[model samples]
Target: MQTEASPLVDKFQLTEDHDSVFPKGVPWVRYHGKYNDLSINIVCPGKDSSLGVDSVGTVSVSLLTYASVQALHPDIIINAGTAGGFKAKGACIGDVFLVSNVAFHDRRIPIPVFDLYGVGSRQAFYTPNLAKELNLKVGKLSTGDSLDMSPVDEAAILANDASVKDMEGAAVAYVADLLKVPAIFLKAVTDIIDGDKPTAEEFLQNLAAVCLALDQTVTQVVDFIVGKSFSEL
Candidate 1:
């Protein structure tokens, strides 16, 4: 998680790091600082305790979001990260997107209304001016825990009409919605899931360049958010 977030943290100069307030052995990391006059905090689900690797996926993100919201009381949340994209959806490696909607692709409940709940569709906060000014592509994002897609996941994602997919976006959206906080999702394309290259190979190859794009785009977004009201966004 820190690897993905490093560029943004560096670009924002978020030097004052705050350790997690959670119980001992929890690995959430928080960095607090200012983006001009705007107060900003960057939270990353730190390494898994036993595994010693980035604690990715929905559970870690959702838990950290809940804790961060309760502690920081942030007015807005930016869930920025890299994601797999679809060439069919006009995505190219290193392209950045502002998510318009988010949903789950792997939670197959199969019941009537529960099926809909399984999908967990949620629209992101409206930001027409921000999108226009940033000149970024806007798309629906589908989230699942798997790094690789299965046929069922593929069908679910297509049904949701998602252009991008990641491990954490929808989870963060769920928390933000529950807390009534506006959120912004900025995703950079790290791999093309529907393309010829293997998913992991492409993702690893493009990660560095994609992170650069993500860093630059997120910086622009924070700059845009400065001095703006929620209604203005």
Candidate 2:
């Protein structure tokens, strides 16, 4: 009833990547080191090889749907991708920080929550215990239709006490809550985003690498879920 199978854009091709340590592939979808109790459903945006993803909400919902339909309902949902880090924290390029909280600084009730487009929304923040496990990297995740990071936006993120901004964290939290599942965001800081024409190529390449205490974040994410295959933890 919850929009059977995937509510994502109708486009996808599941080839095989045996190069992964998990089951079908190392990424996209992988098996947890657990003995048949779990596997990971890794999803990314803006990647040429990734399946159809029109918006953050769509991708998150579809991944959840796919997991349920395929009976791969992961105990935890991990959102891994690239984000623009605010300068306040001196975030290094390729650093991996776990999202402990997501503040929706875009929402406002001009008069009183009556926008025809929709009410600006917010996502559920991470638990304090989870934060401790993830190494306590506070960040702000900004969501928008495009990757345009302006100085004004950067200032806004900094003002909101955010360390990084992304397009999908809000959507992922939106769907994960509905299914009552836990989701941890593992984001890699690529560059200092300021008001300018955003470059998709650079962002995607950064998503493929790391810069922060990455492995720990990954382990914490995997351990939080039903499937945990992190080599260290």
Candidate 3:
């Protein structure tokens, strides 16, 4: 069994935040050192992806994530936040998901040379044995530069077999892959894609609840990570 000195519990880096997106009563800093670590560091990349999904947002998230990885050099990097789910695929509002794989949905490049980058896939690192202990759903999460998806976009996302949509999962995964660091994502569903309500409306309505659920889920994942045997990590 793991102990206080286990590498898995030695450090952690968290990201994804914005004041408007995560209002008061959200415990953004609740997971730190609850299990014997010195502390758990948190970083807010910038504005929420809802404001815009341009290069500015992506760059901010990537840079902050890269900086946090270098600074903490933690055993694991977790990107925890809220996302929109595809109700067609059973992603209902207020649900939490442990991202299994992530890809970009809005990065279509006609040129063959860049097609691979457009749809790049990255797998999250988590102990399969431990994952079985959590009650969260697991599936592909597609990242894009838009909060709302058009019908055409929804079709493409469904084709990719993505169950959830978010703005920063791919960017975070990409940075972790480049740095050769282990990473995982825990996201709560705040809206249902293609639902009758507008994306923003549903997102705001469920933001508080989603934040709380994410906090609880993140804490569980952390506890599981720290409790793992060294061999398992």
Candidate 4:
């Protein structure tokens, strides 16, 4: 997780650690500083206690987002990370996307209204100008806990018309929406799920480059947001 977050840490010089503001036992990292006169807070759900790895997925992101919202009351939450891209949607390795909407493809409930509820689709804060100005692709993003896609998940993703998929974007968006905070998702493609290469192999091979792309793109987005009214976005 830190590996994926490293580039932003370096780029923004977000070096003032705020990890101690939380309880001693809290398992997350927080850094607060200014980027071009706008206060910025970067929170990363830390390693899981038992497994000793990044606490990724919907659960962790939801909890972390709730906690961060309570603590900082940010105007907007930016969910920036790496994701699996769909070649069918014209995604290429290292391409970064500005997610227009987010949904949960893995949340399958077989009932009538519940089936729609299970999808949990939510619109991300619209930033058409930002997308156009940055020349970033605008797409729908699907979230699921698993890194590997299954037949069922694939079908659900296709139904959602997702161009990119990740573990935490929709979860964060859900929490932000619940807390009445606008949210944006910026995902860089780490692997092409539709490609012939094994998912894990491709993800590992392209992760570093994708992280760099994510960092640069996020910086640009931040720069664009600075000094602009929320209505302008």
lDDT of 2 by residue, 68-146 (tens): 4345566556666567775557666666766666644444334644531222344444555556665556565655434
lDDT of 4 by residue, 1-233 (tens): 66678778877888756546666776889877888889998888989988888898999889989988998989899999999999999999999999999999999999999998889999999998899999999999999999999999999999999999999998998899889999999999999999999998999899888898898998999999999998787
lDDT (Cα, 0-100) at 174 in candidate 1:
94
Ranked by lDDT, the better of candidates 1 and 4 is 1
For each candidate in the order shown, give its overall lDDT on alpha carbons: 0.92, 0.51, 0.70, 0.91
Cα TM-score per model: 0.97, 0.59, 0.78, 0.97
What's the distance in Å from true for residue 69, model 4?
0.4
For each predicted model, how many residue pairs clash, with residues at least 3 apart or on different chains? 0, 13, 0, 0
> Which candidate tops lDDT?
1
Give the runs in model 1 whose Cα sits over 4 Å from its true position: 16-19
Better of 2 and 3 by TM-score: 3
Clashing pairs in 1: none
Q: Order of all candidates by TM-score, from best down to worst?
A: 1, 4, 3, 2
lDDT for 191 in candidate 1 is: 97
| Model 2 worst lDDT run, 10 consecutive residues | 1-10
Candidate 3: which stretches are off by over 4 Å? 1-34, 46-56, 229-233
lDDT score of residue 1 within candidate 2: 11
Please identify model 4 stretches exceeding 4 Å from their true place: 16-19
lDDT of 4: 0.91
